[model samples]
Target: MTSANPHRPIRGGAAPAAHATLPARGGVGLKPEHFRHILDTRPDIGFFEVHAENYMVAGGPFHHYLERIRADTPLSIHGVGLSIGGEGPLDEAHLDRLAALLARYRPESFSEHLAWSSHGGAFLNDLLPAPYHAGTLARVCAHIDRVQERLGRRMLLENPATYVEFEASTMAETDFISEVVGRTGCGLLLDVNNAYVACVNHGRDARAYLRALPLTAVGEIHLAGHAHDVDAAGAPLLIDSHGAPVAEAVWDLYAYAITLAGPQPTLIERDNDLPAFPVLAAEARQAEIVMARQAALEAA
Candidate 1:
């Protein structure tokens, strides 16, 4: 794939930024169970997000439904298996598959987590945390650059919802992600729920984290449910389970983030213990209400 300049034309004297426009309001994650309802009902959503790995296969019901749904709604390709922060070089075959999918689907945007999921050729099947050292930053930038080059599009990197902090960490999570965005010219998929979870686990301030985020680099936002766990030390750990409704506290964080980042294409991500379409739809509706309120506040 030919590499195009990631920079976009800027107004005034500011530098050009690589930002993708999400729907001004909100969206929901596309699940297999909700495909028919989404197609038939055509809920008032800004866009739909899908795990790229889930559709990486050749032929099946998933691809058929996704293609059909893509006709109406703007779609976002969110990858869970890219392992862009892993130790080894990016998986060439995986990148090829992703590129092929992009060519076929032509989603409005693409995104992946900032964490690693593979180690020494083994797939962990989970978004594992990565250190924030210079070496790791260089590796992640290289991988992101390769991914963007292969796909012929800029991608958004999400802040991971981590449970543990590595001793080798040399930078704050926000700083690390900001640096990656600076170096690779990729946008941010700001997961507000993850920011809240990390704040709880790491004893950081959620509002401060949101305030420090590179807002101009944010192209999308993620809101998901999480589970509480107890470590061996009897301490609380919040896991990005994505299995329930958005908690009240998370909603508060979302409101704060929208106040800063404005209303980007926000998504409600629920993956396990799946609820009825109406339940998730209701969540999306609630998000829309929040976005409206935020917009109203900004105007006022």
Candidate 2:
């Protein structure tokens, strides 16, 4: 896909320097269940990421422990309810809350989904998809600009795993993502599992989709678990369900993705069916092995 504005210089809002503090090593989604274990063991995790909305409360055990954890390790704030892709004007109140959270913690990285999750003041509690068209494109870019301008920091936008496609879409998913990056100067949270899931569901080539994306804008990578079910037509469907272990297929795709994008701040996300800290750390080790191979390949 051609860039939206080739002549326009890409902005540093999503630049690597914005995340220089976050190592290219692996991290896990910070969960309440593992809070004590993490603090006790102080595992060799590169960083810890959390859902920004979860910590929006002013004072609580979550805040208490996060303070201690932040003192020891780098943190990345991932926002799930920004509704950046929503058609309505960006929610000012929500933005203010997020800005306050960032100011309080000063995480190494902050990210939100490209999907919307709210309509009219009512929250859907799900990351809803948006059609990829010129009109929708303009709306998303403007929302991202406002997010950066209001928060006073560059944020990464993640590609959502979609089960449906819009007839209104005039561009491929990769092209749509690249257009967003080119227009907003935002970095991408390249979710390899999501790309594989969307490709399998849409009968598209996953590797081709990965190869086509603007890898230079990717400051981070995500590996997650998925479920295999059938669509309405009974065709095989891969759901982006982060309930189980990372699928081997997604891991293979991740290995290839990192080879192209080089080492990134890889994250292993398992929001459901939470596993033991050791199990998650073992998966992270697998990611480290892949990076090790990349180091060897580049050296050769």
Candidate 3:
């Protein structure tokens, strides 16, 4: 008999945290602009994801809405400030706040980017890329181990959208991510937009990149839009700007990814140029259609 998710075999020695998994359906990032609409209509979104830092506060309108929305929907807490690839030690205070937030909501999944954002006692507003050599790999694995140990839950590590590569790196990005999951027992948050953006920027094949990932361990998927530009050499460059609609190219890549990984909980992410609730909801439904087609093909 074939396993449903052949690539998701248990790794590492410890058991994963006992949390319910998100349904293999479509979702969207929960934005304040759509909160009231979501509550009033109760859309058919499979799940809702929020940035962990946004709810680390004591109380606010965000929490007020989130608490109510979380009651009926599966929640995904994605952290943007964890700096999992930084050379310094993991931030204990931030980890504590994250733990509290997860405890409160008991989200179906928790994820953070593989990039680092803080250095030398300073926090940056952007997710920065890391070199993929042995030294950096070891550091990343250690950080993820610390996170899983402290949070008492398996966390997903997302691939970063990079504009440049480090010459000192000895391993591929996919290889590095695979090693992290293998060593830490964490899962992968396969960001299709990130995969496409980074591949287009680095002159690699996007499909090849997807095939290289440890897809079976993917707990969730992210689909966002990117801004286009030219490099110093006048070649095409792509930025992972979550301000626009998902590009047609990204949608194609997403379809390919769905076929490879089977249907998973996919999220349509938009953080800028906020649109009405209906527009985002439409896109989320579009993802569902794509997944449904894949399922039909597999069953045939």
TM-score on alpha carbons, each prediction: 0.93, 0.94, 0.95
What are the RMSD figures for all models against the true structure? 3.0, 3.1, 4.4
- Model 2 per-residue lDDT tens digits across residues 1-300: 224322233444434444455788988888989989988998998888999999999798999889988897888999999899999998899999999999899999999998998998899999899999998899998888888878876688898899999999998888988988887777889999999999999999999999989898887889999999999999989988899899989999998998898888889999989999989888888888899898899999
TM-score, candidate number 3: 0.95
Task: Note the residue pairs that clash in candidate 2.
Answer: 14-187
User: Lowest summed lDDT over 10 consecutive residues: which window, candidate 2?
Assistant: 1-10
Each candidate: how many clashes?
0, 1, 0
For residues 1-300, what per-residue lDDT tens digits would candidate 3 score against the true structure?
A: 112212233644333548888888888999988889999999988999999999988998999999999999999999999999999999999999999999999999999999999999999989998899989988888888778878877789999999999999999999999888877777999999999999999999999999999988888999999999999999999989899999999999999999998888999999989899789889999999999998898899
Q: What global local distance difference test value does model 1 have? A: 0.85
The numbered model that scores best in lDDT is 3
Q: What would the TM-score be for candidate 2 when compared with the true structure?
A: 0.94
